[model samples]
Each structure stands twice: as C-alpha cells, then as structure tokens.
Target chain A: MIEAIGVSKRYGETVVVDGVTLRLPRGGVTAIIGPNGAGKSSLLSMIARLLPMSAGQVRVDGLDVARTPGAVLAKRLSILRQDNHLPARLTVRDLVAFGRYPHSGGRPTREDAAHVERALRYLALEGLAERFLDELSGGQRQRAFVAMVLAQDTDYVLLDEPLNSLDMQHAVAMMRLVRRAAEELGKTVVLVLHDLNFASCHADHIVAMRDGRVLMQGSPAAIMTPEAIAAIYDVEATVHEIGGRLIAAYFA
Target chain B: MTAARDPRLVLAVLGALALGSAALFMTWGVNGAWGFALPFRAAKLATMLLVAHAVAVSTVLFQTATGNRILTPAVMGFDQLYVLVQTVLVFALGASAFAGLDRRLLFAGEVAAMIAFSFLLHAALFGGARRSLHLLVLGGVVLGVLFRSLAGFLQRIIDPNEFAFLQDRFFASFNSPHHGLLAIAAAMALAASLLGWRALRRWDVLSLGREVSITLGLDHRREVTRILVMVAMLVSVSTALVGPVTFLGLLVANLAHAVMPSFRHAHLLPAAFLLAVICLAGGQAVLEHGFGFDTSLRVIIDFLGGILFIALLVRGKVR
Candidate 1:
C-alpha cells in the first residue's frame, strides 16, 4: 500500500499541490484525473519522491520514502514520467536492460537477461528490441518506456500521463496492458490520465482533483455522475451508462 | 556488422595510434648519447600522456553530466581560474618569487582553487532546483569573463618585467615537464580514474537522463556531484601541466563518438583517452621533428582543434 499524508507543494506564491492525503490500495489500477494545472502530476511526482513536498510524508509498504535509500525504493516502486528525453543514443534493449540496474548494476546475469526478454515480449517490442529509441515512432517509444518500467519488476508502478503521445489503438492497448499487470501480476498501478472516459472505463478507482485538492474519490459508478463531473471540471459533462460502463461525454 | 567493419576495430586502431605516438614521443629527443636524452624525453612523454588522459576524461565526463556535447571543462572557467592564480602570484610576490616557489606547491594551490570554485558554482546554480543546461553554460560564460577580466586587470598593474614573466607563464610550452609536480598529478589522476571505473556502468545509465537513472535506483544528484568533482580535479591537473588546450578535449571526445558509435562508457572512455594521446603525442612529435616548427606545439593543436570545433558546430552534431 502507498499512502500520502498531508502532502503539499508550493512554488513561490502559488500552491500547486495543496494538502493532499490519500491511500492507494494494493493490487489495482487507480487513475487520477484532473483538468489542466490541477496538480495531478505534482502529486504523483511527490509520491514517487521525484519532487520534494513542501510539507508531507509518503510511505510505501512500511518504508518511508523520504528516509529510504533510493536503490531500496527503486526496487519496490518504479515511476515513468510523461516526457523522457535522453541525450545519448540507446537502443530499446539497452533502455529496458537498465531496469535491472538496481539488481545487477550494469553486468547482466542470465536471470537479468530473462527479465529483459520477458519485458520486450510483453510489450510486443521483440522486433524493435535492437532499434534505437530515437528511430522508433512515438507510440512505439511510449511502449518501449513502459516496457522498461515493467522490466523493473517493482510491486508498485506510477506512471504520469503514460498515454500522452499514443493514438487510440495504442492507448487502448496500453490501458489493457496496465490492467493485466494489475490483475494478473498482482501489482499496484497508479497513473495520471486526461481522458475521463478512458479513466472511467478502465480504472478500478477514480480520483478527481480540482485546483490542487481532491474533489471526489470513489468507484467509477459513484464519481461518473453529472454533478460530480461538473464539480470537478467546471464544465457540463453528460455521464451516460453504456454497456454497464459510465462514460463521460465532454466533447460536445 | 562484420568484424572488419566493427566499431571496436576502429577503437583498436585508435589505441594503436596512441601507442605509436607514445613510442615516437619517447625517442624524439634522442641525441648523441642515448643515456642522458632518453630519460629527459621519457619524462616529457609521461607528462604529455598524463595531461592528455586528464583532459580527455574530464571533458567527456563533464559533457555527460551536463547532457550536452558542446560544453567542455574550460567553459566552466577552470583554465581561466588557473590564469588568475598565476597572475595573482606574480602581483603579490614579484617575478623573482616564482623561481623560489615550489612547483608542486603552486600546482596544488591552483588545483585546490579550481575544485573549490567549481563546487561553489555548482551549489549556487543548482541548489534545490532543477538546473537547465543552457543556464549552466551561461553561468560558466559569465564566470569565465569575470575571471579573465580580473586577471587582465592584475596584469596591467604589474611592472613591465613582471608582466613579461607572467606572459611566458600564459603560453603553453612542452619544454618543461615540472617533474616535481608530475608524481602528485599522476597519483591524483589514478585515484580519480579508479573511482570513475567504479561508476562507469552507472554513467551509461546516467547519460540516458535523470528520470531513467533515478528509476533505476541510482542516486542521480549524488552521482552527478561526484562526477563533477572528479572532472574538476582532472581538468585542473591537465590545465596546470600544459596550460590550457581548450579545443583539444572537444576535438578528441567528438572524434571518439564519431568513430565508436557505442553508448557504453566502458568503451567510450578508453577510446576518448586514446584519441587524446594520439593527438597530443603525435602533434608534439610532428611539431618538433616533421615540420621543424619553432613555435609551441599548443599552437598547432589549437589551430586544428579550433577548426574541427567550428565544423562540428556547423554540422549541428553538438546538441
């Protein structure tokens, strides 16, 4: 279980993440959806220890993230940010193989090689394994990064805007991959997402934030109401129940 | 790729070139009696190889830490700092004081100052915030200008005779090895290289970017800081020994990358060092014998290296 207590992040005069305290349970997919500048990414960064919180503490399992050694936390939890620009040339295999760095450093053992192979196959990147990351298409690169995080073999995975550059087909496929990782692998997955319908259709729990505070948190059936959607986005979103899934239509 | 076209083969060729140059450097000063000439030339050869290794390794590490190809250790005002120290010594103690001062002490003082300045600069610029590479480079430029202006001001205030002595100190010369300082420099370089070897694997991961390195459990901030300190020490040693060859590092490191396309630091570091050795040793040999050039070898290196730097920038390969 990952827990944040009174997490707050302020930049100069503005408070980006205002006193957010929440618990993300184990072995499920939790999607954080918010409008622009809603502090969704800031909150995730704090939880992952990528950003220092102005005031708060985060605990993963029994270890305090702030006090824990980086390598230790890295072994248990992994995070992939939205934008990753590497300055050097690295192939997809090289990038994914780095996932085992905490365990093997740089020298790959037979076991580490097995993990890399499995992750490459899992992401359908076997054909592009040797291809440089810069040469791959946007969606392919996105999957390659995801495969790297998956190869880390962490129990808890935090991804910020994982589907940013992905097309519809790839986005749906990526979501299914997240779902399978949570369900079959028994790993806890937390992600910040923009598309409300995608979050509603796939997430086991929905966390809606507005202006740095949690507006609502519940199952999709409870948080997908017109009143809840309007309160969170400040715009009219018609919530429709189709195929037993609550889909929010905000396009119109 | 086949073994014939393998990039490793290119690295092997460069290594051979470095070795051949070392051999040439050792024998270049051989004269009527082999006994006396060989030791004198061998000392110079050792100094050249050490300085070459120091500059090449530091520049490559600096580029990796900054995540940019165009920046070198000189940009951080390290060489300018050395100049400032020399000028200050002349101003305070007079030209005659330089003859009495221990060369090793002077070298130590200069290196210490450079390392301290670098630490202070990095702390001020990057403390508690994300640092942009552009901003860091800009800060370096500003610092370089400030140090150079200060040194120039001191130079103006000194007597004409003292000014002449200071001027001689500024231009790079291969005639003097300062054997007293060589042992200390070699020891420090060896220690830094060992630490670097321990961190080599993580360095490859580090070049991938901060996010990936952090995700892989490497302490990105601590690791970068350590590398910067090592780079500062190495740069100080090289600049103190041979004055400053600003473009030699940029030329060699880029050549290494062009020749060996591997991202692995294990290969890249050796290739870069070998490239530097070949450039420095071979250029010195040619300047002394092949061309019979009476000028300092630094002039030849700077000329070629400056042109290569411009070409690299024009090709847009330095991003």
Candidate 2:
C-alpha cells in the first residue's frame, strides 16, 4: 500500500498539489484522470518520490519515501515518466539492460541477464534488441521503454501519461499491457492518464482530480456516472453503458 | 546500416597515436644532450599527459552533467575563474608577495576556489525546474564575461612591471611548468579519478536525464554535485598547470564522440584522454620540429578548437 499524508506542492505562491491525504491499495490498476492544470502529474511525481513534496510525507509499504534510500525504494517502486529524451544513443537491449542497474550496478550477473531477456521477450522486442533506439518507430520505442520498466520487477509501477504520443492502436496496446502487468504479475500500477474512456475501461479504480484536490474516487462503475463526470470536468456529457462498460461522450 | 568499428579497436589506435606522439616529443630534435634532455623531456611529457587526462575527463563529465556536448568547464568560465582568483590574490597581496608564495599552496587555494564556485553556480542555475538549455548557456556566457572582465580590470589597475609578471601566467604555456607542481597535479588528478571511479556506472544512467535516473534510484542531486566537484578539481589541475587552454577539452571530447560513436563513458573517457594527448604532445612535436615555429601549442589548438566550436554552433548541435 502507498500512503500519502497531507501532500502539497507549492511553487512560490501558486499551489500545484494541495494538502491531501490518500491511500492507494496494493494491487490492480489505479488511474488518476484530470484536466490540464489539475496537478495530476505533480501529485503522481510526488508519490513516486521523483519530485520533492513541499509539506507532506509518502510511505510505500511502510517505508518512508523521503528517508529510505533510493536504491531500496527502487526495488519496490519504479516510475516511467513521459517524454524521456536520452542524451546518448543506446541499443534496445542495452537500454533494457539498464533496468537491472539498481540490482546489477552495470555489471549484469547471470540472473540479471535472465531478467533482461524476459523483458525483451515480454515486449516482443527480441528481434530489435540490437537496433539503436533512434532506429525504432514511435510505438516500438515506447514498448522498449515499457520493457525496461517491466524488467525492473517492482511491485508498484508509476507511469505519467504513457500514451502521450501513441496512436489509437498503440495506446490500446499499452493499456492492455498495463492491465496484464497488474493481472498476471500482481503488480500495483498507478498511472496519470488523459483519456477518460480508456481509464474507465482499463482502470479498476478511478481517481478524479481537479484544482489540486481529489474531487472523487471509487470504482470505475461507481464514478463513471454523468453527474460525477460533470462535477469533475465541468462538462455536459452523457454516459452510455456499452457492452457493460461506461463510455463518456463529451467531445460534442 | 554499415557496421561501426569495434570501440576497443578504436581505443587501441588512439592509444598508439598518443604513445607515438609522446615518443616523438621525447626523442625528436635531440642534439647529444640525452643525459640532460631525457629527464627534462620526461617532466614535460608527464605534465602534458596529466593535463590531458584532467581536461578530457572533466570536460566529458561536465558535458554529461549538463546533458549537452558543446559546453565544457572552460567554456563555463572555470579557467577564467582560476585566473580571477589568482589576480585577486595578487591584487590583495601585491605582485611580489604573490609571486613569492609557494606554488603548491597557490595551486591548492585555486582548486578550492574552483570547487566552491562550481557548486555555487550549479545550485543557483539548476534549481530542479529551470533546466532549459538557453538558460544554462546564457548563465555560462554571462559568468565567463564577468570573470574575464573582472580579471582584465584588475590587470589594468596594477603596476606595469607587476602586470608583466602576471601576464606570463595569463596565457597558456607548455614550455615552462614548475617541476614541483607537476607531482601535485598528478596526485590531485589521481585522487579525482579515484573519486570519480565509483560514479562511472551512475554517469551512464545520468545521461538518460534526471527523471529516469532518479527513478532508477540514483540520488540525482548528490551524484551531479559529486561529478561537478570532480570536474572542478580537474579543471584546476589543467588550468594551474598550463595557465588556460580554452577549447582543447571541447575539441578532444567531441572528437572522441565522433570517432568512437559510443555513449558509454568507459570508451568515451579513455578516447578523449588519448586524443588530448595526441593534440598536446603530438601537436607540440609537430610545432617544435615540423614547423619549427616559436608559438605555443595552446595558440594553435585554440585556433582550431575555436573554429570547431563555431562549426558546432552553426550546425545546430547544441543539444
């Protein structure tokens, strides 16, 4: 379980993430969805310990994120941020191998190699393992990054807008992979997503945030109502149950 | 795609070039004074190699920290900062007294100042959220100008004779390095390598940018700070030894990248070091023997490296 107590992020006078305490359970997919300037990314970053909190504390499985060593937290938690620009050129395999750095420290052991191989195979990147990252297409490159995060073998994985630049097909593939990781591997996945329908379809729990505070939180079934959507996004939208899944049409 | 040559093979070729140049610098144009010339050339060779290693390693590390290829410690005004510190010391203590000060003590003081300045600059410029490339370049250019202008102002106010005394230390000269400081520079360089040794793996991870590296469990701030301190020590070693060679680091590091084409610092570091040695010891040989010119090697390198810097900027390779 990940617990954030009175989390707040203030940049000078502007409050980005307000003081809010929340608990994220240990398994399945939990998606944080919000409009722009809603502080979803900032809140996720703080929970992952990637960004420092102004006046709060986060505990990941009883270990205080601020006090615990990064290497220690790394074994239990891994985060893949949006729009990573690598300064150096690396092969897909070389990049995936870096996932074991917290464990291998650049000198990969036999077990570390096994993990790398597994991740590459999982992402169907065995053929492109030797290819440079620059040579891969957008979706392929995104899969390679996800492969690296998977090889980390962390119980909790935080992704900030994993589908930022992907087309519809790739975005669906990414969501399926996230759901599979949670179901098959029993990993707790927390992601900041922009597509409300995708989140409703894939996420077991939905967190709707607005103005730096959690406006609502519950299962997708309970939170996917028209009134709840209107309250969170200030949008006039109708919710339809299509094949037992709630889909919101707000684009009109 | 054409197969890239093995990095190790490239390393071997560069190693040979560095060694061949060292030999030529040591043996060429000898006139039956092997007894006296051997030790003198040996000292010069050692000093050149130490400075080469220091500058190459520091510049590569600095580039790594800033996530850009064009900016080096020298470009960030570290060399001028050293000169400024020296000029301030001379202004406060008088030229004669400053000149009378022990070279080792002076070197130590300059290195300490460089480390402090590097830390202050990094902390002030990179405050977690403001890491734009423009701001970094602007800060570096502004600071470089500030240090140079301050040093020039001090030089103008001082006496002419004292200024002449100070002038010799301003321009880089490989012909006359105090023998005593060579050992100290080597010691410092070795200490820096040792300090930087453990961070080697972390450097590769760091090249992935701050977000990924921190998520990979690296203490990003601490590691960058440590790398900067090591960079400061190295810049001081080179600047104190040869006054200041502005673009050698940039030239050699970029060349290393061009030839090696590997992101791993394991290859890049040694490749840069050997290239620097070739440029220094080898270029010195070519200048002293081939051209028979009385000009310092620093002048020729600065001329070429300045052109390369401009070309890189014009080519839009700042990232």
Interface RMSD of each: 2.0, 1.3
Candidate 1 chain A: 10-residue stretch with minimal lDDT: A83-92
Model number with the top lDDT: 2
Q: Give the TM-score of candidate 1.
A: 0.93
Residue pairs that clash (backbone atoms under 3 angstroms), model 2: none
Model 1 docking category = medium
Off by over 4 Å in 1: B1-8, B26-37, B89-106, B128-132, B159-165, B175-180, B294-297, B307-319
Shift in Å, residue B197, candidate 1: 3.1
**Residue A205 Cα positional deviation in candidate 1, in Å, after optimal superposition:** 1.0
lDDT of 2 by residue, B96-171 (tens): 9987988778778888888998888887888658577767767888998999999999999988888887887765
State model 2's lDDT: 0.89
